[model samples]
Target: MSSTKRLLASIHDVSPRFEAQVDQLAGVLENHLGKGRFAMLVVPDHWGAAPLREAKAFQSRLRNWSDSGIEMFVHGWFHRDTGQHSGAANFKARHMTAGEGEFLGLEEATALRLMREGKALIEDIIGREVAGFIAPAWLYGKGSLAALGQAGFALAEDHWKVWKPGNDEVLAKGPVITWASRSAMRTASSLAFASLARTVLPHALDTVRIAVHPGDVSKPSLLSSIDATLGRFARSHRPARYAELS
Candidate 1:
């Protein structure tokens, strides 16, 4: 491989919880060598019966990552069941079920309120302003573009490209992830394969995007695929630092 492309991998989680797996992911990247140069999408301590106390832990840990120059993108206001989405989902949607999304049922007002509060809370906990918003399932309903501008974030990413808020210029363009839609199937990389295909095909592209979820990693095949993806990236370009790009 001639090291023609680079990668940006982001991990998502609901805060004040899942700290273990989240940290384990950090460890995985650290142990994976140069992979530490990637990023982590920090989700908020979303509404629940009581506030999650993990924000404090998130704060301390975030500082270390920040100081080390790790990238941080806001995952969502609440990684909860919004019961709606901008568009519809087939019963087999991977990240969104009909039960989730901006069109599924999320009220525009409530979603914005959560976005405002979540942004405030994450910045308060981390002691730094978050840079972007990634809706749960990457399904920021048709109403979300305006909400994002109001949320005070600077970047937005999905299956398409990395974009600045309120702009059409895609900082990067490519598929973000790969997985089976139904249960019990092994892992795959639509992005990696596409990236590879582009390495030779007529519409050759020079960038690759990688998105990771804790669940996708626990599986052996997916984990290995992720490793291979990182391995390719190691020689391609200095793994990008999130904050630097945004």
Candidate 2:
């Protein structure tokens, strides 16, 4: 709202399955802002598989990334949706994501357990505390909000803003711009949205959150749009970290 124009580049879905793609997208960010200007949203276990603690080399890589000033975030427990949806949830699950909303309807106790376990696992692997947690698909159940406080995460992000977990302290307000490569139609729509955002976003708001998922790297045009979008924002705004938002 202030038109100050702060930029944040985040690499989402950092698991072994997407490591190559993560590296690919990361390289583009590294090229733009140099090492350490971006962030990583790492899933502790993606799709109820591939736990982070089992991958020593990946843990080491995350350590190196953290040490270099790239902020690390606990993405989700198991970035997979295992529940039925209805009404708005159904609409969201059907259109916004490919059913990856893992925390969308979890009970408070279950959500707390997952969040605590995930935070601990990531901390043990990285040997450093994480900066925050972001639920998969940026969707959280009402109970998950309370559970975040119980789990003691310093920060959490939804689609529209970043906030303190326990207290719900709003840190920054802005919609994150991201691309999806789950299908050709999604990729094309995302690019068109991004193209419009390129010309309109900076003038309308102060903060711009560019969240890049690994799958997006698989599409040439999506990747190109990401690069161009970043370039356009960098021309007017300086790179920033979410932790520094407040």
Highest lDDT scorer: 2
Q: Write down the RMSD of candidate 2 (Cα, Å).
A: 1.9
Show the lowest summed lDDT stretch of 10 residues, model 2.
1-10
Candidate 2 residue-wise lDDT, 45-159, digit = tens? 8986777878888889988888899988888878998888788877887777888988887888998888888888888877788888899999988778879987877889989
lDDT of 1 at 24: 67
RMSD of each: 4.0, 1.9
The lDDT for every candidate, in the order shown, is 0.59, 0.85
Q: On residues 89-157, what C-alpha lDDT tens digit does candidate 1 reach at each position?
A: 433233443233432245567666777777776676656777677776666554566666666677887
- Best candidate, TM-score-wise? 2
TM-score for candidate 2, residues paired by index: 0.95
TM-scores for the candidates: 0.78, 0.95
How good is model 1 by TM-score?
0.78
